[model samples]
Target: MISLLLVVGVLVAMFVAFNIGGSTTGPAFGPAVGAGAISKPVAAGLMGVFFFLGAWTLGRNVVTKLGSELVVDTGVFTLTTSITVLFFIGVALLVGNVFGVPASTSMTAVGAIAGLGLAGGVLDFAVMGEIVVWWVVSPIVGFWVSLIVGRYVYDRLDELVAMERSEGPLFTVDRSGSVPVPRVHRTTNRRELAGTATVVGIGCLMAFSSGTSNIANAVAPLVGSGNLAMNPAIALGGLAVTVGAFTIARRTLETMGSDITELPLTAAIVVAAVSSTLVVFLSALGIPASFVIIATMSVVGLGWGRATRRVPAPAVVTGDGESDDPLREGTDTDATEVPNPSALFDPLTTARIVLMQNVVPVVATVGAYLTFRYVPIFGF
Candidate 1:
C-alpha cells in the first residue's frame, strides 16, 4: 500500500508538471513562433533545455520553500495528503487549459499547499504573508514598468527591433569549400536577423523563469513527503514538463499566438521580458510569482500607455480624447505619426482574461481547503 501510494503521488506530481508545461510554453514561446522567428519544435526544445537549467539552479530554492517552509510541519505532507494537494494543482492547470488561459501554477500550488497547512493547524502566516505581498507587488511592478516602457521607450525600441520575416529561408548552406557553411540568406537583412534572435532569446528567458518558479509546484508535495529527494523530484518534473512542451503545448501555442494575434510582437517581447525578470527575481527570494496576472497587467499597462500618448493635453481631464474609444484603430497622430504597432489592445477582452486567471486559482484554493478540512480520506 505504501509503495502504491508513493507511485500515485509521483504520478499526480507528473500530471501537475505536464499541465504546467502546456500552460507556460505558450506564453514563453508564442511570440517567437507566431512571428516565424522559430518553429514550435525548436521552441519546445529550448523550453526543455532552459527549463532544466533553471530547475537545477535557482529552482531548488523555490522547492525548499514550497516543500518545507510553507507549512510549519513537513510531516503533514503524507503520501495521501501529497496526492490530494497535487490533484488540486493538476485540476487548476486543467481549468486554465480548458479556458485557453495560462493558469497561475505557482499561485494554485501555493494555495493548495496553504490549504493543507491551514487544515492541519501548521500554517505559517508570516511566510504566507510575505509571499502574498510579493505576488501583489510583482504584478504591479511589472505593470508600471511596462507602462513606462510603452509610453516612453517602446516606440524607440520598435523602430530599432525589426521583427518582420522575409521571403524564403533565413539561412542557406554554402558548399563552395571542403566544409559546408551556413550563411545568412540574401533576402534577410541584419536587422531582421537580429530581431529573430531577440524574440527567440526572450522566449528562452521566459522558459527559464517558468522553470525557476514552476518546478516547485509539481514536486514540492512529494519532496515534502520524504518519498522523493529533491534532485530526483526535479528531474522527474522536468522530464514531464518536456513531454508536455512537445505534446499539449501545441494547442496553447496556437491559442496565444493566434487568439491574441492583435498584440504586436514587440509588445509580446516586452511583456515577456518584464514578467520573466520579475518571476526570476521572486523565485530567487523563494516566492512563487504568478506570471499570468503579471503578463496580463503588463499588456494592459503597455497598451494604456501607448493609447494615452495620443490624447490631447485637455483630454486628460475632460476625457475628450480619442482614447475613450477602446476599439479605435490606426497609429497616426499630429506629432510624428510614428508606427505604433501596439495600439490594438482591447480592454474588454483583457478584463475577461484577468478575471478568469484569478478565478481558477481562487477555485483551487477553496477546493483544496474544503477537501483537506472535511474529507475523511485525507485525514488532515
Candidate 2:
C-alpha cells in the first residue's frame, strides 16, 4: 500500500541516515581502529550492532519527540513537506562536512523541523524550549565531568591503561583443535590484551551512543509522514547505518585516528568512555546530544585538568622576591627547554575554539528558520 511519493520519501530518509552512519562511525571507532586495537571491519560491525541496540531501545523516545511532539499537529508533515524538511537537514550535514565544521545533526534536524512547524503555525514552543535547554546544559555538564576526570583520575587511569602492543599477531587461529580456536601469541601478555579490549570496548560504547542520538535524525521525517511506523523506520535507518559504516566510515576512521590528532591509547579510551556515556544518557531522555562537541570538550577538559596539576608557580621569586632570570622568561628558549606547565591551557585559544563550534549550530538554526518561513517553493 505504499505510494510512489512515500517510496521516494523513504529513500531520502535512508540517504540521510546512511550519511549519519558514516559521520558517526569516525568518532565511535576511529581511535580503536586507528590505534590497531581493532580492524575496520570489526569496528564497522560493532557500530552497526550497538547502533541498532541503542536505536531500538533508548532512541525511540527521541523519535517520538521529533515526529509527534515537536509540531502540535501532524498534518503539517505531508510527504512533500517531509522531503523538503529532510533535504535542508541533509544540506546542513553537507555544509558541515565540506567546511570542516562537522555540524550537529541534532541541531540542524530540529531547526528544519521547527522551521516547518513555525511556517505552519503549529510549532510547539514548550518542546522547542526543552530541547534548547538540554542543548545548552549537556555540553557544560560534559565539560565539568571531564574536567573532574582530567584532574583527579586521568593520571591513575593512564597508569592503569598504559598500552603496549605485543610482538607478532595478538591472536592466531589454530587448526590443531577440532574447531578453530583463537590462541594468544607467545608475546601477547595479559595486560596488553586487556589494554586492547578496553580501547575496542570504549569504541563500541561510543557507537551505541551515536545510534541513540542519530537514529531519530534519520527517520523522524518518515515517521512523521505516516508512511512508515516507528519500528520499521528504526530498522530501515539502522540498515542504512550499517551500509554507511562499512563503506564510507573507512575513510573517516583513517582521518580521525591518524590525521586529526595523535592521542595516547589511554587518553583515547578515557575520552571515548566519557563522551559516549554522556550521549547515551541524553538520548535516553529524548535529547539529541552532539558527540563532536562533547568529545572535544572532554579532551580539552582532561588536558587542562592534567596540566593544572603541579603547575609551575607564577612567580619563581628569589630571596629578594623579584622575577627570576629575566633572560629566560620571554626569550626564545633552547629546544630542550622545559617550559612551565602553567602554559598547558591557553585561555584565549580554548575559548575561541569552543566559540567557533557554537557558531555553526547558531547559523544553521537561523538559516533553517528563515528558509522554512520565507521560501515559497516548499508549498507549505
Q: Judged by lDDT, which candidate is best? A: 1
- Candidate 2 lDDT at 137 equals 82
- Range of the 10 consecutive residues with the lowest summed lDDT in candidate 1: 310-319
TM-score of each predicted structure versus truth: 0.88, 0.87
Q: In model 2, which runs have C-alpha deviations exceeding 4 angstroms?
A: 257-261, 311-356, 377-380
The collision pairs in model 2 are: none
Best by TM-score: 1
For every candidate in turn, the CA RMSD to the true structure comes to: 6.2, 5.9
In the range 1-380, model 1's lDDT, one tens digit per residue, is 44987888888888888877876788788888878777889888899999988898999999999999999999999988889888888788778767766678889889999988988899899999999999889888988998889888988889877666789988889999999999899999888999989988998999999999999999998898889999999999999999999999998787663232336778888888998999999989999888778888888788777865543222122356435422343434344324345474777788778888788778887888888889988776
lDDT of 1: 0.83
Model 2 score (lDDT): 0.78
